[model samples]
Target: MNGEGKVVCVTGGSGYIASWIVKLLLLRGYAVKATVRDPNDQKKTDHLLALDGAKERLQLFKANLLEEGSFEHAIDGCEAVFHTASPVKPFAADPQAELIELAVKGTMNVLETCTKVPSVKRVILTSSIATVFCPKPPLGPNDLIDETVFSDPSVCEENKQWYLLSKTLAEDAARQFAKANKIDLVVINPGFVVGPILQPALNFSVDVIVDFINGKNTFNQRNHRFVDVRDVALAHVKTLETPSASGRYIIVGPATVTTNEIEKVLREFYPDLRIADESEEGTSPLNYKASVAEKVKSLGIELTPAETSLRDTVLSLKEKCLL
Candidate 1:
């Protein structure tokens, strides 16, 4: 096993992506100290506790992102820290305070705790593609975005794109803190992550697929960049295990997809479901833009196929009675 009985801590362990990370960590022979908002809440932590090696290796800790020193105990004596806890609330009355400030403060708190914990060797911060490209540049049809491109805070703030603003600022804060403190930090920036979710609740990304299946008219964007949740989780683990892995890696499918592509696959597999038609809204022609960076290729992470990801997502939703 690659983990070799090492100890690591994962913040926001119950989240859709974090839970899968915990599962993979355990399977690879690592003892995991996972943090949740409330340890006593079985609803949130139960899935984590039921992993293959949970009884022997997994420990749940209560921690908060905004509260300073909250992650100290959870991060103490750990080999690495996977700081995946970030606020996903998109519709908040105070975007600055609720989303932006909270995301930045939470990241700082985790990094501060890592500095206090001497055993912490590397920090794998989960970032998003929102930080890679800005809405202002208005991606040209021929443009290919990579890790070098950064989201402009001014652009995000001016447009009231609070979610992107939060991710952008939070990632910047993590990089600055890690550099000043001499911590080995590697960031995984994933795109439109959608796969069989390990967590019980429906995440915003998965909900996008759910809404489409239920015939709800959502999603302003025409092209949806999809990546498997498992692939994203594997990228995090691989980045930590591979000593040479550094900097940001964009984890997404090789090609971008649209709702029509997704709908076609869904309808082919599931004829009974009521899938939304893109023609209903008179969507533009299929513009499969949004390419990923070459950094992910260096990690040796083969992304899952879009059709396989979509099928597994719906199947998992059905199993959980959430579809």
Candidate 2:
């Protein structure tokens, strides 16, 4: 189907990734129904409202992820839906109430809405690599981790990986519901999403870079997977446009790098900043590999380089005065 005048809904449109999805959808000339927790929050919605084609093509609807039927109206008459709302906070006063319950319940709510809304043909869900992460794969021999691997629920429980557990369960629930109802569902499992931000608030992923710049001692020291935010947004667009796109696409960059390598690159570009050295204590080594070459290559999408992604992310944060 042509995307030109078709209607699509993007839940959590005010978020870091959803905002870019909304922007790209609008640029493609789609009538976008953007659902935010509070449509009246100008600070959050203003950037979306200011997009080039948003004046008439983009519509904001107030919707809550936890509310069962909240997404029905927003999704009505839309051909596709982008579910990007999920809690990703590192710590919560109540992990279950704040993160686990919300992620699972909110996903169920969206799935229920899709069932009720008949016009919806495809649902593109934004799931994290957490769902695919197996901190300790069973005596793994393979060098590259793909979409087949999954996080160990028991390990998550034991290690207090509440965030990973929440995303894993939510995605599992979404997939099960979609399959039972015979709905077309596509999931994008992204690693650390980093790049420019179109929203007013800073993205949590950016904090990893910010922490490194601000002399924070504790952060990911080993090689970690990352994908550009813009690449992630385009992956959503591709999934919507390409009917053959199905199942899960591990949307990570082809390369992985350590935090130290990133800091070195940043230091070369911005030497005046207080970027901390790797000599800081409490840094641990990580050994993991992820493969997205076949999947992303098949989709005809190219990812941004690690250095480019890091540089643009930091510059954008500085421009927004959030650095």
Model 1: ten consecutive residues of lowest lDDT: 279-288
- Tens-place lDDT per residue, model 2, 73-99, is 899999999999988886778989999
Which regions of candidate 1 are displaced past 4 Å? Answer: 135-138, 272-290
Q: Which candidate wins on TM-score?
A: 1
User: What digit string (tens of lDDT, one per residue) describes model 1 on residues 1-323?
Assistant: 88867999999999999999999999999999999999999889889999999999999999988899999888988999999999885568999888888899999999988988889999999999878767456555676777877888998777677898999999999999999999999999988789998888899889988887876636554566678999999999999989999889988788767666777788865676555544432222123254574788787877799889999999999999997
Provide the TM-score for each candidate, comma-separated.
Answer: 0.94, 0.93
Whole-structure CA lDDT of model 2 = 0.82
TM-score of 1: 0.94
* TM-score between model 2 and native: 0.93
Clashing pairs in 1: none
Clash count per candidate? 0, 0
